[model samples]
Target: MKVIIAIDSFKGSISSSEGGAAIAEGIKRVYPDAETVVLPLADGGEGTVEALVSGSSGQLRTASVTGPLGEPVDAIYGIMGDGETAVIEVAAACGLPLVSPERRNPTLTTTRGVGELILDAMERGCRSFVIGLGGSATNDAGIGMLQALGYRFVDDSGHEVGEGGGALARIAQIDASGTRPELTSCTFRVACDVDNPLYGPDGAAYIFAPQKGADAAMVEALDQGLRQYARAAEAHLGHDIAGIPGAGAAGGLGAALVGFLRAELLSGAELVLDSLGIEAQLADAQFVITGEGRLDGQTSRGKAPLGVARLASRHGLPVIALAGSVGSEASALNSQGVSALFPILSGPMTLEAAMDPKATAAHLQGTAEQLFRLIQATAGASS
Candidate 1:
């Protein structure tokens, strides 16, 4: 029997690689000769870099970069096993986790560190960049990243505007003389799943700023600043970036990468599966086991587990979804190629207890054994 285990990180509980390993170990207990391949996946959010690095034989590199608040933070990016592609997660540098709750401020945050990482990879001869734009704490329309890449945003007085979205209101002329020429020779794949625009009632500021510590006033200010930034970018770049789908993601960092970097924006789950070559692995597998931290209506909205199910279905393989928490009409997952949705919590427990790494790991293993046992019973009865 052959089974492929592809699962996302359980968010604060287990790494995706570990989750796959636990499942594989369980499957082994029931069918020791079962061929299992583990591919840890990410949906372009936190831990994306680690997922990619762990699944592929990749080299990890770390550097000091400016954080969301201009503090020094250690950022990591990876060169994939193929040696030509670089995988970078913007969150590693400008993520919300770097700041305390009291210090979260979207208006003042920047993607400068992301740009620095990109530049660093470019210098190391990585030409193709897979950039995961999630978990950011900025709404600066990627101005900071642009600045790091040699684009200049000057204020009304022709002085270079400082970092942060708050500076977008300044009268500006953008100069792109400094953009790296190597960028033109490279391919940029932006991994994003959200479809929000950069400015509007449904845009970045209105939808995401509250989580970044914005008050009503800050949201309003940020909305206006994004408008200003959009106007400036449109005047100079001749593209309407604000209204583009996924442009508002990561505090408008998506728009910046798309408009300025000419990145091809794609669903994070799709991109990760493609990178890991899911289709090839699914070819002869009898069953495909996939999972994530939660499964609900959102699972149908392009999450990693859904991605895996869709691919598995195409190959006529049954898919089982294992999750930490299955909620609110999670039966809807069946429509997305999931045969059954399994919640790993064995008993009533606090969220903390349910998600405890050690406990969750053991539960996952046991769940796998149960699944294979059922599979074996059904096959025997049918025969």
Candidate 2:
């Protein structure tokens, strides 16, 4: 019997490979001779770089670059096994975690480091890019990254505007004559699950700035600033991507990428799964096991586990998903391809206790054993 184990990282607990290993061990207990393939899974968020690097036998390169508050931060990117595909997560450069809660001001954060990472990868001969736009700490509409990439945003006096979202309103001119020439030869496929427009109540600043430490007043100001930036970009670049889907992602970085870089925004889960070639892996597999930290209504909204489930179902494989927590709404996915959703908890425990790596692994193993045992029994009964 062949079973594929593709579990997402239980964030703050066990990693993807670690969780897969534990599940493999449990499956072995029921079928000692079963073939189990454990894969690293991610949905283009924090663990994307690590997952792609490990899954594709890629190498990680770290570089010191400008952080959200203009501080030095070490950002890591991945060069896939082909050596031409560069995988980058926006969080590595300007995530909320990089700044303290007290200093969390989206107006003053920057995504300059993200551009520097791209430049560094391009210098290394990587022309194919897979950028993950998630967990950003900026609302600058990606001007900071554009600046690092040699796009000049100048005020009426021709002086270059500074970094941060607050500076978006000061741009009167944009000069792309200095951008890297090699960028014309590059292709960018951005893993973005958000669908916010550039500016408005549903736009980037209004939807995401609060988490980056903006108050009500600051959100209004940042939203207005994004409007100004979009107007300037439309006038100067001659393209209006303000109302595009995912344009509000990562604080208007999506707009910048779509307008200037010509990036294709895609679903994070679908993008990662396609990169891993899930269809080919499931060709002869008898069963598929996948999971994430939690299974809720949001899980059905194009999360990694849902992606796996859909692919496996098409191949006529039963998909069992094991999650750390299973909400009532998760049951809705039963008809949507996921055969079953099981919680890993064996007994009640505190959140911290449940998050311990060893404990989570143990629960995963125990849950997998019982679930697979039932599967075996049902198979035997039918036979």
Candidate 3:
């Protein structure tokens, strides 16, 4: 039998490659002669870079860049095997994890590092870009990133505006004359999932700023700033951007990508799957195994495993999902193409114990072995 293992990273436990290897090992235990192909997978979030890099036999390049708080941080980006495509995760530069609870101020964080990463990639001859817009720590409407790209935001006095979301309202002019000339030749595909608008009740500030440590007053202030920035951006770019779906993702970074970079926003899962050529991988596979940190109702909404299951179903291949924890709504995945769901746990254990890399791998392998045995017995009984 030909079994394809395309599992996502078990977040904080094992990477997608490790998880797929564990499943492959389990399948080997049950069907020693089985042919297994392991493919690392992600939905363009935290592990997106690692997944795409490993899956495509790419290389990772690191650079020193300005962090959300203006501190120097090391950020990593990937160049795929094609050598012309670069994958970047915005979180690497200004993610929420980079800030402590006490210092989590959305008003002060910046996305400057993201621009640095993009510039670095461009300098290396990458013309095609896959950018992940998740886990941001800023509410600056991407102005900081724009600045790094040589777009100057000037106030009424013609002085350049300061950094952070607070300064967005002070912008009176936008000067793009100094922007990198090569940027016009690049193609950007942004991985985005949310549909929040640029500003208002359902916009970036009101919906996501609180998590970045914004208070009610700060949220209001940030919303007003985004509104002002939107007006300026529309006037300068001669296009509407404030009400675009997903314009508010990553604290309006989505809007920046669309309005300034002319990027196409796509479902994160679909983008990653296309990058991996998943349909081609499923062509000859007898079975597909996929999983993630958790399997729940949300999994049906284009998560990696569900995406894999849907594609596998089209090929008439059975798909089994092995999650670290199965939630009450996991049954929802069955209607979306998952043939079976298994939790990678043996018995009662602390969350920390179950999350250990080695333990998680062992449990994943053992679970796959048992699942194969059950399938064998069922096939025999039906025959």
**Winner by lDDT:** 3
lDDT (Cα, tens digit) per residue for candidate 3, span 119-222: 99999999999999989999999999989999999999999989999999998889999999999999999999999999999999999999999999999999
Task: Kindly indicate the candidate among 1 and 3 with the higher TM-score.
Answer: 3
Off by over 4 Å in 3: 376-383
Q: Candidate 1 — what's its lDDT? A: 0.89
lDDT of 2 by residue, 230-265 (tens): 888999878788999999999999999999999999
Q: Which ten contiguous residues of candidate 1 have the minimum total lDDT?
A: 45-54
TM-score (all chains, Cα) for each model: 0.95, 0.95, 0.96
Evaluated at residue 175, the lDDT of candidate 1 is 91
Q: Which has the better lDDT: candidate 1, or candidate 2?
A: 2
Q: Rank by TM-score, descending?
A: 3, 2, 1
Pick by lDDT: 1 or 3, better one: 3
Residue 171 accuracy (lDDT) in model 3: 87
Separately for all candidates shown, the number of backbone clashes (residues 3 or more apart, or on different chains) is 0, 0, 0
User: What value of lDDT does candidate 3 attain over all alpha carbons?
Assistant: 0.93
Model 1 TM-score relative to the real fold: 0.95
